[model samples]
Target: MADGTWRPYRVLLGSRLRSQTTYRRSFAMDLLGSLSVGALEFGEIYVIFTNVDVLGELDFAAAALLFALATICFSLADMVVGHADRLPTYLRQGTLDAFLLRPLPVLAQLITSDLSLRRLGRTAAGVAVLGVTLPHTGITWSVTTVVLLVLTIVAGTAIFAALFVCAAAIQFWLVEGAEFANAFTYGGSYAAQYPASIFALPVRVLFTFVVPAAFIAYLPTLALLDLPGPPGLPSWLGWCSPVMAVVMWAVALTGWRAGLRHYTGAGS
Candidate 1:
């Protein structure tokens, strides 16, 4: 953690930011598109509630809270690690090989190469939803509630970021694995917006235990609302999101290192 170590990242990220902001109209359009996508995604929850008063155990307001939390976390995580999804294209174009020649770590270089400012629009949309629905969810305002909310957002972001990196790591072997990676990253985001109780047992277990997507929003929302979780998930499980994030990072880093070792370069 020396300044020297961070200097390269600062330069790279700074340039990326400047480039993104250089065109005002383009940046604004990007934000609008991103915000529209965020709104449309939440529209799925809204549509379901329009037809029925409840989804699983959640009413419309409660479901909105869940969507906001999950969307915010997923958007923030995507801003950071979403570029890693280009691993296949980088491998094919020899961009990753050039990164290997740089003084910085490959992962660090990849991350700093392009910072997506547009994802902030999605984050903003989530904040809007949270602002609108939070009071209606019957969450008590307390120091502990505030702390849990903050922790949930931070932990959820980490969980999703790790998933992105881990999924990208698979591309070292399967150069055509973008869809496979999307299944966990984007697909996980889509699944996290709803109540886990609505899914079948097998799907619920897969997301909860294997992918830990439930920790991103569902369990945390239940904890915030002081409601009991359905069948297998306990309300207290929400507090375990930080632990889950740590475990996920461990898996992601291990897979990343193994992928690096396995990589033979673009020529191979």
Candidate 2:
């Protein structure tokens, strides 16, 4: 974030943007594909909830609130960290060694390698969903709630991005376990699209304490929903989202550093 770094950062990002924009036809297809996939995921929730008034204690709008928030957060994270998905492939091809030789930060180079404009389309869809559902969800709108909403989105984005970073870093040691890391990255996003109360207590606890997925949307949505906490759950958990985000980010960065330290280098 130095004043000197801005020029290089812009150069790297703008170069990728120009190259990615060159494929107009492919870009259009990717944009539509990303948007449609999000639509289908939300549609599944709609169809399931229509037959029943509530899943646990959450109504359709409440659940949709969670979905919209999760979608927006995940979409933003994907645009920034989606390139991390290919780190393992680069390792296998020795392209990672080339990255280490670059003058820029390794993470920044990896991120700028691909910006993935298609994610912006998905983010637009999420914004539309949020605009539609928010008015009907009966939130007692206030400046504090609004601030909480924005912070929740920012924090959620950071948490998801960190998850991607951790997953990529794991490739340093286990090339074959990309799928294992993905189970948490993608699976965590998928799981967050619903009310936390809907999942069993064990799963809820794992996401909350281990992967920290619940803070991305579910817990924050609950606080904003103007609803009571499920069973014996504390009402304050909703306000704890920013804290959870900070904690998860620290953990993920630590994991990334540890992985970098253990990296055996190309052809190891």
lDDT of each: 0.92, 0.84
What TM-score against the true fold does each predicted structure earn?
0.98, 0.95
Candidate 2, number of clashes: 0
Look at candidate 2 and give me any clashing residue pairs: none
lDDT of 1 by residue, 1-268 (tens): 6998878778888999999999999999999999999999988888888899989899999999999999999999999988898889988887788888878789888888788999999999999999999889988999999999999999999999999999989999999757988888888998899899999999999899898899999999999999999999999999999999999999999999999999887783
Worst 10 residues of 1 by lDDT: 176-185
* Best-matching candidate per lDDT: 1
